[model samples]
Target: MTSAIPNRIRAYLGWCPMTGAAQHPAPDQPAGAKTGDLADSGGSVTGRADRFMHLTIAVVVLSYVVAILILPFLPEVIPVHWNLQGKADGFAASIPGAFGLPVIITLVTLLFILLPKFDSRYAGFALAKDIYAIILFATTGMLLVMEVIFLLIAAGYDLPVITIIPVLIGFLFIILGSLMPYIHRNTTMGIRLPWTMKSDDIWKKTHEHGGPLFMAGGILTVIGSLVSGIWAMALMLVIIIGVTIYISVWSYRYAKTAG
Candidate 1:
């Protein structure tokens, strides 16, 4: 019996390790390895320095928007908040009101439009433009939420049952739109499960399927947002996370089998 057991273990160990997944163009390289369009273009900046600049700009714009949205609700020049965790936070509460969300959005949107023109390779993908629109819409909804919260605090307004509908719709559009660029590309964004990143085909297929799934889920999220209240947001989050995981695993297995 011991000899038989040893033979069985040996057989198992000898099984093929590759598992039949389709062999990628190069396993060691990241997905979208070619980005060759970027290398030859004078208009594009591929250095880490350029990337940092872009990220810094994005953060600044986001901060400016937050300030614009929060200032109008402040009773004084200073925005103050006391948290249950024993922290006091204070800022210029009137900043958001002074800027007005619409004005902030417009300025940010202009930046998005102009930033893409700076790069030749990225000019084609135009992610900045899309992100700009998504951020604007999202900011609008967030401003509305802020208004609701303020009303609840100062006016005892429960936030009309119907006013929330538009906010929900706006939120869905924002979420779905935010995923678009990532849905279109395969590098360092939007649900980077290890297996999916390991195989290029898996990344492509998963995103191809996941893009639509997430969009649909986002639409449902809008519906849920207006109908079921906060719980709806929870459900939408679950669906997005769950579908992303499922597709990642499926794509990995499928690639392995096809290869």
Candidate 2:
């Protein structure tokens, strides 16, 4: 009965059951299709999804190009670090700061693109490819926002770094939270606690509970950002950390009871 639990949960979640070595698709197999016949039927859906992925890559490339074009006009030393008080405390040479960060963002975006194809649990990833794509796009957009923030500071804008950081983080949390429930259980992402990993039901339930909690926390964070000083940062951290602990404990207890 315990062993059968995962399959039941997978069924409830509308995910295909993994079949040992055959879970991974063949080199020529179309994703999420059972056979070539089904693949042909699903071709249009797959093609549309691929086009969205291509568009995301194009956006990343365009953002990088814009960053590079602005590089030469920045000051010799750029602000690279900020304190809780919103003051710049660390600096880096404009050339490396401008170029290197965008390079790193591009590499990270490439990794996100490759992850679904290369992860050990690619089969599970394929099951949730649409959600994965949305997550990837949101993360890449966040990185681009960070790049823009750096560029704005480098260009001598009097932006409120400390407040902006918290609000952006809150927005990111809200985005992730909104999508968390759709994320299938996989080793490469999501709340990967031992008990959650052991039980599919627990993973689903945890995310179901966690998703709302995260959104609430994110709201609190955004509200906190309106206040100056370390208090806002401290409150945001407490909310995030508190939710994490709550979900882990809840998942463990739920799993134990189910067992």
Candidate 3:
């Protein structure tokens, strides 16, 4: 039974392995071609998404390598948390703690790649394959930055870890904002709400209008995170909250009429 697990997983993934990339056959291929065949086929969406999966795997592998190299140099008790002023406010003595983030990010990468396969509207993934690839790249790339920051702090770099995290998060939001308009309807991710999920047209419209607002908010977040004093992160939090509410209301209003 154990031996069949991988096969089952591969079967479940439908040979695309990257966010439902090959669920349907490519046009140029013979109608009789298998799903896995598209992964190797040039100029196809499946081929592009599969390449993204490969890069994501490489990032995860590099994270592990970084953790291994830095573990030896980290202090016995390193700061795990930082204060508003970027001072170390918490500590832990686990040397193996370094590997924790690598493991987490590995799982996160998998989640980004695999979760879309099971999306209630699973077919949506194929239409938004590029969207998935870009989002995955942004997500793993941000986590990689966080991973590096953690290690550097553990090695006593006296870095502004707290201040930097929000900026990174802001950039991630910016990336998501840019991609929102391109996203097809999917329940597993995006600005999913009861209203937006009702229709594909509603989803597209909401994203088209909301995408710019989100980008504006992300810009504010990045700016707010950079400003010193008066709790920069708090300002970012407020901006994020305000932007979300605005976007939600817009989507809801549009969806109400759309329905």
How high is the lDDT of residue 48 in model 1?
A: 21
TM-score against native, each model? 0.44, 0.77, 0.79
Q: lDDT tens digits, residues 118-139, model 3?
A: 7887556565565576578678
Error of 2 at 219 (Å): 1.5
Candidate 1, which ten residues in sequence have the lowest lDDT sum? 15-24
Candidate 2 matches the true fold with a TM-score of 0.77
Scanning candidate 3 in windows of ten residues, the lowest lDDT window is 26-35
Candidates by TM-score, descending order: 3, 2, 1
lDDT of each: 0.45, 0.67, 0.71
Ranking by lDDT: 3, 2, 1
Candidate with maximal lDDT: 3
* TM-score, predicted candidate 3 vs. hidden true structure: 0.79
Candidate number of the best TM-score:
3
23-107 per-residue lDDT for model 1 (tens digits) = 1112223433443323211212133224334444454466455555555554555323323221335344454434444454456
